[model samples]
Target: MSSTPDDSTAVIRKTALNAVHRKLGAKMVDFNGWDMPVEYPAGLIAEHLAVRSGVGIFDVSHMGDIRVSGRQALPAVQHITMNDASKLQLGQCQYSAMLYPQGTFVDDVIVHRFGENDFFFVINAGTREKDIAWVRENTRSFDCKVEHLSDDFTQIAIQGPRGVDVLQKLTDADLSKVKFYWFTRGTVCGLQDILIARTGYTAEDGFEIYVPTDTATSERVWNEVLAAGKEFGVLPCGLGARNTLRLEGKLALYGHEISDSITVWEAGLDRWLKMDKAEFIGRRSLERQQTDGVTRTLVGLEMIERGIGRDGYKVLDENGKQIGQVTSGSYAPFLKKNIDLAYVPLSHAKVDAVVGVEIRGNAVKAKVVPTPFYKRPKRS
Candidate 1:
């Protein structure tokens, strides 16, 4: 970690959209090394409900953006990732995990295929610098170039039912054709030649726009997005609402749900791992774990009793035996109940299985439930 100039207190970096967030009266907090907005006057619960019902915008500029461009782009990425990059066509994006040589997770990343020789990766904020360093070390053998572009670009996610509607008003691109996990170069808010990806943390219709760092352009795009989204009920959301929204969607958090000590198979992400694609870091260990059967698994839990199960809370059996621990939890505004994701033995992860969470030294009843506590209605 880098030290601050004062050396007495921690210094948090502010984003290009920090002014906008503060102007909206957002509750700011130290997230990792960044000063981020956690919530707004609308509150976490209200913002969660609004996204489930309407639309919202989030400043995710803190997330790291890296560009990998060279003749060996595909093979270079495939060598480091667990997913098969050969099948990825231009404009397609795939979620993947980077593993150590031993197969333990380093970080889960999203790769966007811009062209045959160019690609983009969006990595977790907490692991930004570490992830870049890992990529550079691993790609040393491959004939590829990886550049950390986090400082050059900023990201904004417009999520929910009306995301496209508001984006279309600002951009000339035909958004309907940009399917899920795909991207295109287009003009947004009069900024020509920018990349837009149809992706988001919230499990809803949305788009994540990458804006280059330029004072005039960033300011104009940020303000125009909010202005155009007025009729769509677009709310400027913070990390608090962002967390709740992702929790309801069952999206994995890097440090919480997954970390350098865990493997993807144990995290319920085997479907995203492509073992048949030759080989990748940690393949042998993960393959061994798969054959031996994983001991612990990540699953969703619903509180059958009162109290919200928070991170670090222990899960116990009916007989008061410690079974597992909650990784992330909250009072889901859409479900109107407490929901959480926990790591427990596979034997106790069945749906409807009884469990108890230790909250404030008291045992609260809970039950194993299907993940993705809420899903948006499919548009016809």
Candidate 2:
């Protein structure tokens, strides 16, 4: 299925589970050029709540993966990425980004260390070609080899509060001992030696499994996980709920939160920007910006009036002057309030600072507030 007749005529690619999604009555839409399910018949809100309180599964096979291996892999990876890759140990992962020479984004990525000289990257689907090209071109000078492994695997994410219990039922490995941002291999659902990582985008305790891309294996893994989690209220989630979940966690989206036009400082990603690290791409530009100071920064907004401010909605100051625009916004199903993430002038980004979002040509009142609007209580 496609979002419109025009979309159907285009060369839209589908995941291995495209038919399964249609059979489940998903509302399919053209995301970039990929035919993806935006929401299920159960609706976005229901799927959102299921992940927050119970468990939800997502077909994330469309996301791309790359592998780098060689004795100089660390220097090769460090040259292209902003984080300090030397700190990564075996089977560890870190949230990092690949940037252009201008100190702006190529794409935010998750770097995983599989071995001493072997590293992997999970990059955004929309920027797959660009990211791959950037990495290959820039790191070619280093004594390392880069391989495009995107087509070899399909990734499945099981997220939410009850996600752990559901996943442990299928694997013999002791998932409870796996630390956050760590990974291990095990036979799951009779699939031999697949990678299971304690990582997710939903800001919940969860695991993402890496399985072969064959439709039969992928569907079997999907169905078995659903059946195993049926008692825990696990639902099949689509991109709509996926967006809301990541937004609620203040997770950076490549196009929305970070982009070629947006600098790392403006996106509030200082924690991952290591200036003391060995010289890397965009380091000099970021260092100069740090001295000059940032003009605008990202902030969380709570809509005070009775309307939902959507992405690209104009954010106005108290005097009805346009300041910034909403990068992401929604009536958060789990939070039960309208919330947004936006970039405004430093002067207006303070906590409790009043601002207005132009909703339907009218400036609706909103206020700046703390982020991660919802955080699950830590396990006992």
Give TM-scores for every candidate, taking all chains together and pairing residue i with residue i.
0.96, 0.96
Question: Whose lDDT is greatest here?
Answer: 2
Q: Which ranges of candidate 2 are over 4 A from the true structure? A: 1-10
lDDT tens digits, residues 124-221, model 1? 88888788889898888877889988767769898988898999998988999999889888889888888889999988888999997665567678
Model 1 regions lying over 4 Å from their true place = 1-10
Worst 10 residues of 2 by lDDT: 1-10
TM-score of 2: 0.96
Go through the candidates in order and give each one's C-alpha lDDT. Answer: 0.85, 0.90
- How well is each residue in 210-311 modelled by candidate 2, as lDDT tens digits? 999888988899999999999998999999999999999999998998999999999999899888899999998998999999999999999999999999
The whole-model C-alpha lDDT of candidate 2 against the native structure comes to: 0.90
Report per-prediction Cα RMSD to one decimal: 2.5, 3.0
